[model samples]
Target: MSDTSPFDPVGHESLADAVVEQIETMIVDGILKEGHKLPSERDLAEAMGVSRPKLREALQILESRDLVTVRHGEGSFIAPLSGRAMSPALLALYARHGRAFYDYLEYRREQECFAARTAALRATQSDKDRLRDIIDEMQKAWEEDDAEASQEADLRLHVAVVDASQNTTLIHMMASVYDLTRQGVFYNRRFLRTMDGTGEKLLQQHKDIVATILAGDPDAAEQAARAHLDFVEESFRLGEEQKARETRAAKRRKLSGQASR
Candidate 1:
């Protein structure tokens, strides 16, 4: 019988992730070095026994993660690691989706905390105003009792803070950083069952963050961001524990049913 475990290439993960893992291993094992040119697209596809499109997709993933540098005319080269540029997207990739939900959230919170600290050091007056506008939007959404609106405003608020450092590259790099955090924290925040005054509480905290930014102190902004992340981390922790317990119960029930049969 053929093996059908999720660890198989055609199972749990995308083909792209599987191919990326294979290439990453070669690099890590010293088979590929910095500035080393990888095989031509066709050659790589032949070697991996995958289609050209699948191989390209895997290379794109590697490019995004800074593991490989694709030069338009010069082909793909092993990327340098002189300066590590971390983001929530990288964290999400590391987390491996729902199976690693809580683990991913923890990593994202750390990155957000670091960005917040840097924002305090570099935010400008315009950045401060942008933060205020986001908070005001949240407050209005809360008064209207609109969860979607409130959550969206909450998302923009966090992203805007990271964008405030005026580093266009950083801004672009973190474009999708909050995606995992959104699924982790906002699901609970938006749910009526798990949420109690979460929208209002977040509004209040956002207001405080705006005030800190307006005061032109990065230290205060950093503290406010940390405080907010703390609440978010706690929320995910409880959710994680609940999920773990349920998973074990499901497994036991499955075993019991099999034994009875």
Candidate 2:
């Protein structure tokens, strides 16, 4: 029952309460993610250095709180906790509304900039390694001209940055936000990619962000994140305008053809 273990030895007199608190903390910290299965009763009790009776009591408490789901044949598992953050009906509304798209970008700018700044200051070595690996994937995708892969890597990099921030709230929130983007709530996948030179520019912006964070410059990291979002916002607006112009041109062409007929 080392301190570093997710389930440490219970020191409190109320063993059941202590076990419950420890498990709850792990869930809140994102260490034990949604749907992760708990160990068997015997194994869990041994790991936590608590009696099986006390462990069972804690499990009952967690189930009552709706934090854990215990199946008859299967072991206990963390409940689905992300449903509140990712409501399908709300996401549908956001996808249908044009205004929600830009509003989401604005929200992301603030949250992502803060994440980048905090990651710059607090990221562990492992976090830095993961970020660098994502950058490598992005670079490879760009070189190979794989637009879809590049976009996926871009989303992953942003999520990784938030993870490095070590803030549980931001980690969960940004994940949901990006999930919406993946579902096309903000814009179509081809909106930015269809434009000339946009891919190259995006790659460069991503590079700058990673560079700043790797340098451990909090201010520079925040600035880089802001700059990247600003570019994306401008690009989206331009794309929308281009689509409008194309639509108008198509209508004019159809009218001319009809008149000739």
Candidate 3:
């Protein structure tokens, strides 16, 4: 994973896309640091077992996304992350595969519980203050009926908790998945709206988690965090079931109408 050896070429029709993904993975995983010079075009093409034209196409796509900078006659270099962690390709991958989102949530739930527990034991007064401020913003967002602001505040609260843990590794892990976190919140917003009283329940859940942490009760903080996620998981499950039932009923009605004709 550390070395940039030749990639094993899979027989996919979209070779250029594959090339883009491989390069993107390297960048994301820190194998290719910012401002690091990329291999020469010819060498890179050979290493990837892709045609030069295909490699050039992939580089162009990366350049378009600001993941790579192509200086004329100077080859290519990895671009500095200007606060952009989510690539269009990565977003497309998640959008195309619904199961990936569920898998991500399950992983996030565990990490979040640990973060909350650690935060309870380690948070400073300043950390508590920051958490409270975010919660205040969240409350205001909900009161104003601004879903987008509420969602952003919700993410900030969770991230703040993770930071409060004073665990650098945990912080970095969350940062790596930052894009997926935002996407999940946005995607789940539609189903979240369908669950009655969900907004109020969610607000209270956030408050409970923060209050437990602030009390320095690690056990309670962990429990509160897990309980909040349990509700979220259930909401998603119920929402999906409702959507499925509606689809089936619609199909039955269509079939009955055809039979009558």
Candidate 4:
């Protein structure tokens, strides 16, 4: 996406507002993508046929809305629209409540299943290649015991699957919760993998998902994704159960020590 073509001069009564709307329309339409740099003040003003003062007002409006970020000396650039709005709030929820994390997984399960099915049906050759590359990276990271890298690769693979879905709305929706997903799923992956045989099983599951998608088997892709997430959810439950048991044992030990004293 790029800056939109020039429009007629802002001769309307609400000139600044009209200019703001024009720029907003360009951004909302994806003509100016996240992180894309805007034209210089003079260039933009000339292009839009608006006075420099009017362009500044429009820029200020965009900045206020966080659609643009202005740096000292440097020009304005498109701001990241997804995380700015939701990340902090979602992070607070995850931090405050354990169950919020599981709720996220439930949401992810539904979204990923749909993404996997759609990807199987629509993935381009390039998307398949990227998935294969990420899988290879996962394999290398796992073999080298690079847990962080492996988790990153795992997340990337899932994100790539969603990207292959070719659904813009779906993409945006997933992107909105991506930070929560990263924190909940990727951050906890190491602990889950520590369970005996769990890491190997997960690796096989990832392979199955990619293979099914490559084979253009939407049903199998969806099943593979569901099966993988089912394993993850069960692991989460078992981990919580173990923690409860450990807490109970600690309490009992404390009580025994107190009685002996």
- Which candidate tops lDDT? 2
How accurate locally, in lDDT, is each candidate? 0.68, 0.85, 0.82, 0.81
User: lDDT at 24 for candidate 2?
Assistant: 94
Ranking by TM-score: 2, 4, 3, 1
Q: Which stretches of candidate 3 lie over 4 Å from their true place?
A: 1-91, 184-186
RMSD of each: 16.5, 3.5, 13.6, 6.2
- TM-score, cand. 1: 0.52
| Model 2 misplaced stretches (Cα beyond 4 Å) | 1-16, 35-57, 71-76, 85-87, 143-149, 188-190, 196-198
Across 1-261, the per-residue lDDT of candidate 1 in tens digits comes to 124211223323567777898778766533454567887877666555677788789889999999999999888998864333345575556555554555545665666666677777777776778887888888888888887788788878878877766555455445544554455523445642254444666677778766776776767777787787677667666777888999999999999999999
Please give the clash total of every predicted structure, in order.
1, 0, 0, 0
Total clashes in model 4, counting residue pairs 3 or more apart in sequence or in different chains: 0
lDDT of 4 at 205: 91
Give the worst 10-residue stretch by lDDT in candidate 1: 1-10
The residue pairs found clashing in candidate 1 are 120-218
Best candidate, TM-score: 2
lDDT of 3 by residue, 149-206 (tens): 9889988898899888877667757766665667663265545755846488888999
Which tens-of-lDDT digit does each residue in 1-261 have in candidate 4? Answer: 125544545666787898888877766544455777888988888876778898899889989998889886999898887654245765676677778667777888999999999999999998899999999998998888888898889888887898888776676677666656575632478877976354778888999999999999999999999999898888878888999999999999999999999
